[model samples]
Target: PTPAAPHREQAAWWAVVGWLGLLLQVLLRVIRGAPSSLAKLLRSLGLRHPLLSAAPAVAFVQLPSKAPADDLPPLSPPPGRLTVVLDLDETLVCAYESSSLPATVRTQAVEAGLHCFDMEGISSDKDAKGRQRVNHVTVFERPGLHEFLQKTSEFADLILFTAGLEGLSCRTFILLSIKSPVSN
Candidate 1:
């Protein structure tokens, strides 16, 4: 049996109302994307959005509003070679942080025949420490680190700086397969 015409009209009106509600939601999203809109909403709640506060300070990136340079000088060569410096501990080795040793480095060195060595003490072997000594040593490098070091060095100069023992740096780099750095 065909539905009554009045019922059909009522169903169409409900569908139209739902569509209007969806369009209104899209409009709300667009309006909310504006920083000012967010700021106003935040203010209404007795708060200031921190990002909005600092944005104006950096917003206008046009030429300096103040006086132009009084005189321009010819550019001079940079003082030294373009050197990239990297830290050995966190930057090169993966350490446990709170534990005595960064797990990965310690394990790698041991497997490579480093015996009676403690990660806390910067030692290549038991005899090197002379006795029970404790110092956090970055013994190995991060994974996939050799390829990165090689590729980077082949292009630009790289420097690996470490506060570890004088000789430790060499062994550490070797263990990590890091090539001789452009500069130490």
Candidate 2:
């Protein structure tokens, strides 16, 4: 056979595999009601209507049940100090854009020992015209935050977690560590 024939055969084989995969997916969707996204994708490809008519109905088999294990050991409390994971945004402190903060929050922030600093060199925030603007974040510590950290440190190791940007997290860590009396 010519080299072209082999290439054609391989292409035909892949086409068959692709169709089989599509058919199996269709069968699964029929067995379980199709998800909206999957239904949309099928419709977009013009395969939904044809597959619905051409595909064979698939039956799902029930899985065999297993006996519960009675020899498992009873759960025991942790041996050492418990670990406490705290979220940074609302739990330990609240960070806000300096320009939009309310008067009450600004006052409380002052009372709570707020940390205000300008963040430049990065364009994360957008202005009304959609141009990127540098961020100026003001972070306000929660009431009794220092005392809470001190007390918690005696019985537990605290971990600060945040969903904010990397720079914010680094700044938060540095600022809190500088203010915190607790030793590593």
Every model's TM-score: 0.34, 0.45
Scored by lDDT, the top model is 2
lDDT of candidate 2 at residue 171, scale 0 to 100: 77
- Give a tens-digit lDDT track for model 2, residues 1-184: 8879989999999999999999999776663464466666766778656444434578689875764577557779878977888787777877777678777867766776764444433346778999877777777777777778888888888888888777776777677767663332
All models: lDDT?
0.60, 0.71
TM-score of 1: 0.34
Q: After superposition, how far is residue 73 of candidate 1 from its true place, in Å?
A: 18
- Top-TM-score candidate index: 2
Runs of candidate 2 exceeding 4 Å displacement: 1-78, 108-132, 181-184
* Model 2 per-residue lDDT at 175: 70
Question: Where does model 1 exceed 4 Å of error?
Answer: 1-81, 95-140, 174-182
Write down the worst ten-residue block by lDDT for model 1.
115-124
